[model samples]
Target chain A: MTEKVSIKRKVKCALLNILMYISCAVICLMLAGIAGYIIYRGAGGVTVDLIVNKPSLLKGTIGILPNILNTLYIIIMTLAISLPLGVGSAIYLNEYAKNKRVVRLIELATETLSGIPSIIYGLVGMLLFVQLFKLETSLIAGSLTLAIMTLPTIIRTTQESLKTVPGGYREGSLALGAGKWYMIRTTVLPSCIDGVVTGCILSIGRIVGESAALLFTAGMANEVLGIFEFFKPKMSGSSLTVALYMYAKERGEFEIAFAIALILLALTFIINALSKLAAAKLKGKGSGR
Target chain B: MKRAANFLEKAMNVIFTFCGFIAIAFVVLVTVFLLVSGIPAIKEIGIFNFLFGRVWASTAQSPSYGILPFILTSVYGTVGAVLIGVPLGLLCAIFTAKMAPKGLGTVIRNAVDLLSGIPSVVYGLIGMILIVPFVREAFNLPDGANLFSAIIVLAVMILPTVISVSETAIRSVPREYEEASLALGATKTETVFKIIVPAAKSGILTGIVLGIGRSIGEAMAVMMVSGNVANMPSLFKSVRFLTTAVASEMSYSSGLQRQALFSVALVLFVFILIINLILNLVVKKDVK
Candidate 1:
């Protein structure tokens, strides 16, 4: 049965429809404006010399080579140390944990970890790494702080993929006289490579964008370091975001800041794309269609 | 040989169990560190005076250690952000979830992802360049970096989460419910707003709570555009959030000042913990 709509109802529906479209348009326009404006201003400032050179006081020049290396050093150090721990924890929770209560507790702790702010992570990193452990304000201290922050992300992703590994695979391997660890190594772990890759990409995104935590632990120095120097106790260097803050806020050099911002923006886009690819791959493998 | 294999298995089980507990250890370490460092400043200044006192002259002749201004600013900024962002985000979510064509929805979703991926400092930079000057000219104020600018920036910043979460929630609402509402002669828009939205209320609430957490914990962007003064919050007046208060003064601060910053952080942590607890309880209850 077709029912006649009241005039008031019609007007309200029209209004809501208009409001919804307008809201969507506004959001998209705002995003476009921000991205276009940043790229327009920042891209022109990005130069080869900016990428290859370090900031020099005597020459009145600025570069982000040191910042770039610092960022890479931190990411490599953090992922190297954290990947094993995070995946191990995920395996424990998904495959080995006996009691439900213990699983819940660990999950709760992970949730709490994820919810805590980065600035507090900064403070605790300062107290524990710099003060208690006597690592001082160095890149290693900063990267360890980031490792903790990204642990939940890694564990959650790995555990999710571990869950999707078919039980039949495990049983089949056991029937073939393979031990439990052997079964996992041969069948379960390899299936979740995309999950680990996604976790790594996500963590890299976080480590690249992080500033406050690094500001406290990784002191702001623009000197480029040799690879071996990264592990030295008192070595300090700023990541890209920290360098951006220093250039824009502290040094009042918007040109250099915007150039750095351009690099960061590009990095973010690449990271976002990589994560999407990894997630899509995982989903495809999980469905097994 | 069998005994050695048994020992290897047992050792690995112990190792994995220890790894599982590492997160708990980290949380405990963080909490204990904050408590050990944070308590001294509060102890130095009476709890009442520290929390509720209006003045915050940390570098004065006789420095005062009150954090009311910071607390108020953070609360007001978060509330303001939520009020402005939630409606727009909700409307956008509904549009994308139900109204938009497939290609358009994907584009909007990608845009939203890109928005979230941009760092907070970049947001602050954009706000400083654009919003700050606009506010100053529009209001004829000497300084535009104030609570209002921070709220505006925060509103934009939180939109990605609100849009994505609410869209997921709304999409998850059973299609049968909406079909039933439409079958009852209700308009499409009516079914969406009245039926789908109500069913997805808990998820929307969770998004809002998460937004509030983001706004409260935000320091770098807020510090840039908030004109970090110790003033009590007013819409157009300079203010300091609990976060910026710590970040702005942590460099070169000494004695009671440093301790007080820790105290402020502790208070902020308590606020975050409460928010987290509330989110967990509500989500759990709703699930049950």
Candidate 2:
């Protein structure tokens, strides 16, 4: 009987061990397969002409220059608006807020904002920015919508880093006759720069990956626009992700879509590496202190 | 110089306070706008018909505005994704937290991060090229773009969240429990399964809730693989989710059709709010 019980235990343990090994293998293989397939299919379609010139009917040539430019513009516009607002909110919550109830409410609101989906952001952006605010279906409208969406990411990261700042630093600055804002600007903010950078990289990843949010607010007009033209209320443009949707789903142009996917995959890789590096640096600092 | 510094401090405090209120203001704005735009259509269609009606042909001559199909599809797809994703993710988390060596664990964690960072559109593109055709040929169905493919895509998309969150939870289980279990002559596997897992249960539940939120909100990927039809959902049937229903038609929809899409969004929002509340409760319990 004891021998039989021992055998049963061995069988159960072996079964669980096999399951774990299989699960890990499945995850690793999925990533490798997806990345390998995309590179194999998409590498041949990427070219200088595709990256530099706009699509032309006369030449029968396709290009993504307009979409690329629009992506850059939206990224810049979104960061410009959100960075200050997000960082300020974090500072207030971490440094200045006295009431615990108020802090909890703001944190709850931020959590709710993060939980709301991008599609809902798109709908609200259409109603508020595009129609009520009269920005129309322009890049500006899309940027504003994304600004709100990314706020939670920035605030959460910044608040976490702020928490790690040693209390001695703040108190020391105050003892040396530095005002609260001055102390934060000179000492607190500089030390937590890694967190801010990580926040920025994560937000950029979200903006680049976004499609459903931009589809309605930023209409799919691929005409290349100048810097001045970006601010025009009527100027509508499509980012690379939206363009990918149109090419693959609407136009049956899979080659172009795959090429765009390759670019996005590259961007994702770079963003992931940079954010990881920043987080590691933050950790190193925390331990050193 | 002293007066100027004091004035600067006061001004900066006001500015920061205003910035702090921005999050609350935006949440209020989103709720108000979705409610105002979404209510009229529900009223026009009648609440009962809008929620429970079986048909959703919004562009037909008479234009029925029922969303029962989309609601059912979203529910079914999310549940399907959870069924496939949770077990796989939990197993993977166990490997990372308790089984693997340090170097291999870091490599797996980084891979999971990269998986999470990949764009949704890229997932859709790959699904369109690969999964759709495979499903069609395997099932011998007329069309491969169905709820099954959508669920497959969603399961993959939610894996990173589930694995990462669960791994963190599992790692936080106190070492004392494992030591005591071993002292009692229980094997390592028994200790991990019977003691550690149960202790980490709330954290794992939080991850599952988060994955549900992500899979339910997904639009472009589901739209690409699911063949965007307003049919009652079956395992192999082409279906439209609440998200895809709004996305596929928002551009060309007019009048009541447009308003009804907003109503669909409102319903999705309410579902998300409920999920968020549950997540909060789970997290609070974990903290306690």
Candidate 3:
């Protein structure tokens, strides 16, 4: 009887563990279901006109061309600015700086900045970028705000990647009579390229998902603009997030909003997949992936 | 040539150091800017009242700058989200790091990575369309958008952060600890809870705190389902948080009202800063 009870207990424990695993799987399934639902509602909405034409009430259709352009523009600008700043700070923290206190301070402050509410960042942007600097809701203003918003992520990830570089590599380069800058440029950075790239992709993912900071700085306009005229005061380009917001805010626009959400989910899934792919490749080549 | 290169390298080091200093300087500047602008409202509505008051109204004659109501709402939203999020996220993390087959673990981790990449606004739209209507019908309530709905949505949004961090923390635990537990005739569950979890407690706590910070800082999605009402939190009642309060009012607000909005931000900033500092200190101790 005791032997039977012990076997029963073993079976119960195994079942319990499997049940726990299923619960975890349910969360991921819900997210995937959300993505699937979006694609189902939006597949028919994808068209050339939808990607290029202006939004019109008469047609009962909303094209996301302008929002797409703005998102791309802001993303490019954010990367351009943050990449150098983030990588430079990481290098300085890991390779050059000897003092530990200053490094700790930077680490602490960056984490705090990362945690600061994006709405606060928006408020700060309103004060410094829009009012004080008189940028007046231009693309440049929006891009700068986003750059700052994602800065901590970029810096933290880069710093993590930099820290992963083995100390022997740096010492080996130095012992070969290479100068400090040369050692960092050739040995340290080359060895950590995978990490740096991971950081970049992560920051890009963040930029693509951001909304609060862009709301105030990147004025909401759904109209596309000429190359040079994109920064005009009256021009408004709604990003995927902002556009979905406008749709949800207005009554009788649920279908369009749902469709846009579906597209947004697709974009997110693709970016995330690409980031994972890149990380996998990089890690396979460098580490024991 | 070597001497010249050394001088050049030293100069480069100084320049890089100065640049890092600038990033730190920016943080200080941001804090001071928030506090300085918020001073006007702080003076007008005494610090004690502003922090303690429950009402958040702005009018010409008798402007009210109470943030207690909003703070309670923000706190509830965060706590509610975390309550639902942490366990599920921790479970997923443990499954991915220790329990799952290799192929299944990769799929689960990738799914989480994708979920994290989805924008908050997109999440809001999802909440508005699916969660909102379903909630309204199921509860037989007046409005679909309420604290309950907000909590559900926020939980979904924060899941990825918690899961990712916890997985990393759990994976960092030494395998020998688990091996020894198994060899001692402990069941897998016992081994995991008694050995693995205790060893990774600090990292797991860090993950939870980081999730808190993320949930607290989130504005866009919470703004959508929170119903934007500035009242005490009820499961079925609509409420506005500190973040949604600022976003909804900032566009049209002027004078003391605008400053009051900044004050709300200052309050939130200080709150999050304190949490981050504590988290960093805790993590620092563990790292050493």
Model 1, residue A8: distance off in Å is: 1.1
Candidate 3: list runs displaced more than 4 Å.
Answer: A1-19, A56-61, A164-179, A230-236, B1-11, B59-61
For candidate 3, give the lDDT of residue A39: 80
- lDDT by residue for model 1 over B167-229, one digit each (tens)? 998999999999999999999999999999999888888888887887788888888899999
Residue range A88-166, candidate 3, lDDT tens digits: 8888888777889988888777777778877888888878888788887767777777777777877776777777677
lDDT tens digits, residue span A55-104, model 1: 89899777889999999999999998789989989989988899999999
Query: What's each prediction's clash count?
Result: 0, 0, 2
Best by lDDT: 2
Model 3 residue B114 lDDT? 80
Q: What's the candidate order when arranged by decreasing DockQ?
A: 2, 1, 3
Give the alpha carbon lDDT tens digit for every residue of B1-288 in model 2. Answer: 999999999999999999998999999999999999999999999999999999999999999999999999999999999999999999999989998889989989988999999999999999999999999999999999999999999999999999999999999999999999877777788888899999999999999999999999999999999999999999999999999999999999999999999999999999999999999999999889
Which ranges of candidate 2 are over 4 A from the true structure?
Answer: A1-5
Quote the B-chain TM-score, candidate 2.
Answer: 0.98
- lDDT per residue (tens digit) for residues B1-288 in model 3: 878998989887887787577578779878989989987888889999998997776863776778898888889989999999998888788878888899988888888888888889878877877898899999998898999999999899889888888889889999999999988777777677678978988888888888888888888898888789887777889998888888988878888888898888888888798788889887987988
TM-score of each: 0.98, 0.98, 0.92
Between candidates 2 and 3, name the one with more favorable lDDT: 2
Q: Is candidate 1 or candidate 2 better by DockQ?
A: 2
DockQ of each: 0.75, 0.78, 0.64
